[model samples]
Target: MNAEFVAVFVGSSIRFAAPLMLASTGELISERAGVLNMSVEGMMLSGAFLGAAGAWATGNAALGLAIGMLVVLPIALLQAFLSVTLRANQIVTGIGINILALGATTLAYRELFGERSSAVIPGLARWSPPGLGAIPVIGEPVFHQVWLVYLGLAILLATSLVMRRTALGVALHAVGAAPRSVDQSGLSVTRLRYGAVLFSGVMSGAAGCFISIGDIHTFTEGMTGGAGYLAIAAIIFGNWKIGRTVGACLLFGAASALQFQLPLIGVHVPTALLVMLPYLLALIAVAGLIGRQTAPLALTQPFRR
Candidate 1:
């Protein structure tokens, strides 16, 4: 392949992976804190709808992004209350939330934009690093992207540091590993879990906004297209480590990018298979085909104080 092709492929890969990185990073934290947040899909879809609507109504992509993230908080709160406070079945609650989000967004979109469904929504601005944008041949295509991509990277770095090097991180780890111990030591298990789930919601919302405004500037009925599940898969494939999870997201992104890239090279693969690659890989990872998988001991286990 030529340099142009390589640049396009790499850029597309990054674009596809950005949302996964954001969502999975948040999910990782929630899982680490003993809550399995399966409702990330719903949270992301809600964010996409609200973000697009907010931008379209106010004519400010930035404001729309903020609104999108904020709107998902109530949903996140519900998720936390169900799983952490009421001690409900985490998986069942998550599935219910996802169904609710899908139906609500579909109805809301039709009501708000019925005749103007195809109208052009405002999109987030693009930016590139000072030096990187100036590189030859591959510079613009590979480095220039929606500003959210850079912001997401920064957030990922900060998350890594906080999880690995902070007292708060230690507490989070302890809560996931042994909630009873954390409670005995004066830390509130309910509080930690609630915070983790909320954080996951916020991140998932941003991820959705990235798709609706940052990337496509449009909101389809289900724009996320199972990316939330892909994020969960990335977490599983990464074996719950930050570095590995990031790698898995990139790998999945590349797999997705190939669906388009292969056509350029005269390589004909089934479109359905390409679309299914990430989920299939995730299934393999979950099935222990890769190796022995070990999740947090307290994951999905409700704590009672």
Candidate 2:
């Protein structure tokens, strides 16, 4: 590949992978807590729309992020309640949440911004750090990302540290793998699950915000498309680990970047085929699900008292 192509590829991967890393990592946390969230797609789209709209209205990226987080937090809380406290069917409730968020956001958008032939939405500005761009090869595209891209790397590292080496990590693990045993030990399983769900929501909101502020900078119908679903898939592929999830994100990123550049690469592939790579890979990966890995013992089971 040409030097410029490599730079663009890496840059696009970083941009595409950043959101996946963030969202997938969030899903990892929730799944580790034994609560599967089906609403990530809806949450992402809603967050993106709200974040973009907020930025447009106030012209402040930070405020838009706050709004996006706020939009998804409640949904996370509900998941915690239904799955952790109420002991509802995790899969069904999760899917329900996705539907609710999708409908709610779409309707809200229509009410707030009347439907027209085309809608104009402004998003956050990109920031390329100085000096870093001067590095050979990977500097330009990699370093010239938004502030959130940098923050995402930090968050991923910190999360890994917490999961790998920390007291809270152990407690969270206990709550997921064996809520009854944890409860007998005098810990509140519901509370821990609630915290995990909320944190996941916050991170997902951040992911959605990145899509609005980083890539499109404008809200469209189904702005997040299927990113939330992809996040869930990434978590499954990563087997609930922060580091592995990063790999999954990168894989999907490459697929996504390829879809957009197949023509430039002098290929005459079918458009539909190119667009399906990421999802197809996800199907293959998930289908190859190997030996039974241990999930949170209390997974999808509500904890009472």
Winning candidate number (TM-score): 1
**Candidate 2 lDDT tens digits, 160-189:** 899879988888887778878888988777
Candidate 2 structure, TM-score to reference: 0.93
The ten-residue window of minimal lDDT in model 1 covers 112-121
Candidate 2 local Cα displacement, residue 122, angstroms: 3.8
The count of residue-pair clashes in candidate 1 stands at 0
| lDDT score at residue 211, model 2, on the 0-100 scale | 91
Which structure among the candidates has the greatest lDDT?
1
For each candidate, the alpha-carbon lDDT, in order, equals 0.94, 0.79
Q: Give the C-alpha miss distance for residue 41 in model 2, angstroms.
A: 1.3
Model 1 lDDT on a 0 to 1 scale? 0.94
- lDDT score, candidate 2: 0.79
**Ten consecutive residues with minimal summed lDDT in candidate 2?**
116-125
lDDT of 1 by residue, 33-143 (tens): 999999999999999999999999999999999999999999999999999999999999998999999999999999998834886789999998999988998889889
